[model samples]
Target: MKRTFRLSFYVICLLIGAFVVSWLIFMPNGQERGAWRAETGGVVLELTPLKATMFSETAHSCHTVIAFPAHMKLVEMLEGATVGMNGAQLELAIDGTLNTQRFDRLDALPENCTAPDPASASARDVFDAAWTAMDEHYAFFDLHGVDWAARRALAPAPDARMDDAQLEDMLLAMTAGLDDGHVHFGSDTRGYRSPAERPGWIPEGSNLNRDMLRQIAIANAGATITKSQTAPIFYGLREDGIGYIMLREMDVDVPIGGRSMDAMATAFANVLADLDAAKALIIDIRYNPGGSDTVSFGLAGHFIEAPLPVFTKTTRIGTTQTAPFTAILEPQGDAPDPRPVILMTSKLTGSAAEILTLAMREIPQVTTLGEPTSGGLSDVMGFTLPNGWGLGLSNQTYLTMNGDLFEKIGVPPDVPVPFETAPFLDGKDPVLNAAIAEASKYLQ
Candidate 1:
């Protein structure tokens, strides 16, 4: 009996040991646990493993391996880089894993690949390579309605006398070759601008500075018709107790609580409060170049009765893997009975503004007027390029509540108002006028 009892105890111990081994074998690794604050270059960033896979085809020497870090998606790592993680330097092999070799033995890539300019390679050559690669790889290239070959053929000549504006125009032409609405060229100082020139928007003798442009934009927003003074940003006539607000850009930072957000919230609230007694609202962002979307939502919430999904964006994991798009919503605010709303847009409005419009587009009481928007409906995270130029491109594609993609094709207007020159010249907006005419029916 003693022998049998001892044997049973040994058997139970063996079983427990096996279970422990199994658990360890199947447990998730540190990489699978999600985002962690990591130190890189004396700066700490929220780091997450994008995707790590093992490739074991050992037929050739120097096993081939690849690794894509989350930061790499935002900023490309230098070639031949020895990635450091968890206090360990990782070596890449052709075999698709990072743990194959010694620290500092592999190469590290500089900001722009650390590759010296090829022998006598001009900026034009670099531009060509980038332009061609973008044309080939950018998603939704065909929908842009641009002639890539023709534009490429018109490459800048040797010793091209390109001013900042001309250089920007050329870059714009090159980018248009990709034809993705979300792709654009932005200034290092200014965040974004109109890709193509707008009529009378540029001020005469206006130096490229904050004060000069701010004054011009403000005057455009509130210019009087009787005055011969040129105002490019805005000009409107109040009608039927409903004041039409047409805007071209919202790029300026509006301080809120001494922060940009505080300013934006105040601006949004003040705009609505100023027009409180109005029977209807026409928020015309037809040529709006887009701005902070959080502000768009705060303003949009004023008209919504319930929360609704506005748009979504996703991050790419690697060449093949992609993360799910994150969704944003329009929250309901304390507006009295939700005022009737109408929005005007063109192939120009985008980003945060697009998200706002999409959320309100389906409501029965709200109607979108004018032509389709720019179709650049994506969530962008801005970063400085290696050349000290700031860029904000689509990091994720946005989808509507009904699972519709609004990337290449813009949001269609319920009432399509074609562009007319005479009304614009006379400072009478056809889109706003139409909205007022339509709202008059509801108000009556």
Candidate 2:
């Protein structure tokens, strides 16, 4: 699985076998002097192309396909390279999937290429390389209230006598004060990560599968079964005149992933159309880990009745941040009139799922219940240590429209209720139970 650099602890990636027209650039664009450009339509992204063997036949083949097992439509079939010095410029919409790709050879700096021989560098050299990279690219020091300079000063340096293990410890110490989950340190084998919040992992031994949900909807809700658009997304009406749309995550079918936002909006429109007869609606995201922000926005747009500013974000460059980019939400495609809506959540809900919660909270008829979402925001941007080790950090910060920050602190539920997997083990759902009871108030 392959995903964008802007990932939470869990974000997946994959795109269609694009690059068929593989716009190859052997010479410089004469723009960046040493760099070249490969343009495509979609999200603006710079992809690193590792060294590829050139036999004079040109770039061809999906030699290695990386898949990100997340809940998103974002995917790319990356092939060919130039020692990671080459990069591609992808033009993806603010809410579009990346189905196609391009390739370009760029003569860039060493950090963009593979690391130097690990044996050639001292333990201290590797540590310093990591420290310097963060000094230049890491983004959330201010938000975490961390004095990175002071912290760096106090950090224990790797001594010549220290082994690789000790060096790893020293690197981990550099960001211990920062509660950003995006922070990461890794060698060829071992690794360490600082979680933004706790209790965010999925519950153990939980069997919340499509089969289970289908059984519950049929046996208890007395809903009609339609063997269409199965799994991932489920929609139907309950015996008590209530409707539900339980999405496993903000994902899409591969075919649909290559399309535009209108495609996703139309999918939701169809689901809502099926639930049109119900008196109230229940939207469950209790098990969703996360995916693309665009997919989340696409789903949320269906319920949004008016243009509303939900969240603002900015990239951290050096000590300052980039200009703020605020995301607006409004109705798209066919949407039902405002009705009593329940959003069931849990610690598992994070990344774009958190974005969805943030967006839904603004509506008057929507009430979020169950556990708070995972506080893991920001994309995990990656860097290469001098010894070829991997270093990841949060280089962006997302905030509410009112400028409220929830980093390391999740979005709280309007009605807090602990969800238990044991209930699912017994062929029941605690989250659904709570939603059903809450739906009582709106029942006419």
Badly placed stretches (over 4 Å) of model 1 are 1-137, 142-176, 185-239, 251-263, 316-321, 330-337, 380-392
Per-candidate Cα RMSD to the true structure, in Å, reads 16.0, 11.4
**Model 2 CA deviation exceeding 4 Å by range:** 1-122, 137-139, 142-147, 150-171, 187-190, 195-231, 256-263, 335-337, 418-428
CA lDDT for candidate 1: 0.48
The worst-scoring run of ten residues by lDDT in candidate 2 lies at 54-63
Q: Per-residue lDDT for 33-75 in model 1, tens only? A: 3222111110112223444322111111111122344333122
Residue-level error in angstroms, candidate 1, position 208: 20
Residue-level lDDT for 270 in candidate 2? 74
Superposed by TM-score, candidate 2 places the C-alpha of residue 32 at a distance from the truth, in angstroms, of 7.8
lDDT of 2 by residue, 142-204 (tens): 767877777557444455645678877878777777766568888668988675433533254
Q: TM-score of the candidate numbered 1? A: 0.56
Instruction: List the global CA lDDT of all models.
Output: 0.48, 0.60
